[model samples]
Target: MLLIEALTTGGAQRQLLNLAVQLGGRGHRVSVVVYHLADYNHRDHFRGEFERAGVPVTDVPVMAPWRRLWAVRRTVRAAGPDVVIAFLRRPGLLAELTALPARRFALIVSERTGKEGGRDMKDLTRFQLHRLADAVVANSAHLEHYVRTAAPWLRTRLRQITNSVDLDHFRPAGAPPPPHPGLRILAIGRFRPEKNFLALAAALRILRTTEPALDVTVDWYGNNFFLGQQPTGRSRPYLELLDVLRETGLEDAFRVHPPVGDVVALYQKADVLCLPSRYESLPNVVCEALACGLPVLASAVSDNDRLVRDGENGFLFDPHEPRSIAEAIRRFAALSADERAAMGRTGRRLAEELLSPATAAVRWADLVEQVVEARRAAW
Candidate 1:
């Protein structure tokens, strides 16, 4: 059983869906239990895909917190899965609680973010509950270190499993898009403060003032709101970014787009992929961009150092400093066309070596089997 908050369009949710599909293909009995169903804009986003892949999805009806817990426990009991893998904090906590009474099954909880991402109280509670899990999965080495440092008790159970990219689908185009009049920059992710879209706008403003002759246009893709888990209705972050653009006279140089299904196409059309996030566990956008042979300019946070070799495949900068971002952009913009292409090729090689979906799935399967067999032996 694979448990998660929802099948939203976020990186973690998408990775969960991919793992479920791959696990099922490996001849394992797989099913997904979604905690909240209606909270997402594209509620049916991965439902049909799961169904077609022979994975049943159970939606736990919404109710009070206690009732929801009861419902999830009941659903798990009905499924009678040998092992339960839960993603995100809430699902991990619920899985720990659910596995207590039914100790026959193994429980694996995934921590997708750094310890600093959540409130102290919530992190403490999660750390306590994680002690009961058979194992804990961290998406990046940075996250694993964060968890171990915060709760030393998790040292034995914790394992780092980096997020995977569908290399076959995100492969580089036969040739780069024909050079255009201006540089085309692409940024994709949820519209949240941590993403620092406003900072990107600020950097662009600095670029316009310092290098007025440089022609660059940025296309930002992502939704203003997120569903499931942290259901947000606040459009203020996105609106503030728009306000910044207007104030900086960058309104004409930027465009905002909602999240799209064909993100590979966006990568193909873009000259460079920029991620100005304050922090991340293991950003899937970076993995996908590398797979698509696009050079990156991202914040030097989390596992970005592992993904990007400075001055090799891409450049990393201090996200807090708009001037640093502007400097990185200047560096990228100054590269010759052949130099840029070489950098992109390096990125693609890194993706193939580190972010292969097949490799990640095999690791997931091995961990699941290891835990399940250990539980059976103990029983």
Candidate 2:
């Protein structure tokens, strides 16, 4: 069984969806449990894909706080999953606290963040409950180190699993839409304060002045609100970016796209993929772009060093400094069209070496079997 807050358009959720489909193909019966979602028609509606794949997905009905635990427990009990794994922190807590008592099923919780991996209250409890989990899955070397430091007693088991990307669907496809004699930049992430789009706007403003003849345009794809409906002016952060663009006379040079079910076409058309997040563990966007044979321009955070070889596949910069971002952009923009295409091809090779979904799913299946056998032997 896989547990998560919601089957929304997020990285962890998408990874689990891909893993579940692959696991099912490997002759495993997979079921999903999600908390706090009212229906399957909302958000990214990833639940529909699971259903279409014939994977049973149960959205535990919303209820009072205390009752929700029981609801999750009841739901898990019904599913009778031998191994209960959760994709994010909140659901991992629930899986550890509840799934252990209901059955001796092996529990695996995934930690997929870098520096901001811990919290004051919830992490304390989670660290204490680490003993109960059969294993901890960290998606990057940075995240794996973070977990080991925070919970040193995890002689239990900490495995670094590169977050999976669908190489088959994400590869370079049809020719990009009518191309102008300029560079196209693509960014994907939430429109939150952490994403630091305002800084990106500043960097783009610099790019406009520094390279007046070069037609550089940015297409950012994401949403601020991921749960369900957007609250009043929830797009304020995205709009503020627009304000920055308009004030700097860059409104025409940038475009913001809402979340989408598929972004392969976006990757195919773009010259490069850019992620300006202030922090990230191992962003799915970077992996997806690399798999799509799109050169990357990303913040120097997490294990991006392993993925991007400076000027080879992409350029990484200090996300905190707009000038730093601009400098990296300048480096990428300096490359000739053939040079940029070569970088993208190199990135695709890296993706195959590191982020292949087939390799990832095999590792997950092997780990599950090992944990399940260990638990069974203990019993």
**For residues 1-379, could you state the per-residue lDDT of candidate 1 as single tens digits?**
9999777667887788789877887899898999873354554555766777788888887678989988999999888889999998889888999987658888999989653354487787889889889999999998898889889989999988899988888989987788788789999987878898888888988998999899989999886764543445566787788787777788888889877866899998899999999988899899999999999999999999999999999899999999999999999999999998999999999999999888889999999999999999989
lDDT of 1 at 338: 92
Local distance difference test, per candidate? Answer: 0.86, 0.82
**TM-score winner:** 1
Off by over 4 Å in 2: 37-42, 100-102, 116-122, 174-178, 226-236
Give, for candidate 2, the lowest lDDT window spanning 10 residues: 36-45
Measured with C-alpha atoms, the lDDT of residue 336 in candidate 1 is 92
| lDDT (10s digit) by residue, model 2, range 1-379 | 9898887767787788888998898999999888983432235458778888898877777677678888998888776678998988778878887855546688898887555435567666777887778899999988888778878888459998888887888897655456567778998877777788888888988877887776788888776552345433555776677778778888787888777777788888888888888788888889999999999988888888888899899999999999999888888888887898899889999998998778888899999999999888888
Question: TM-scores for all candidates?
Answer: 0.93, 0.91
lDDT comparing candidate 2 with the true structure? 0.82
lDDT of 2 at 95: 81
Superposition TM-score, candidate 1 onto the true structure: 0.93
Predicted structure 2, TM vs. truth: 0.91
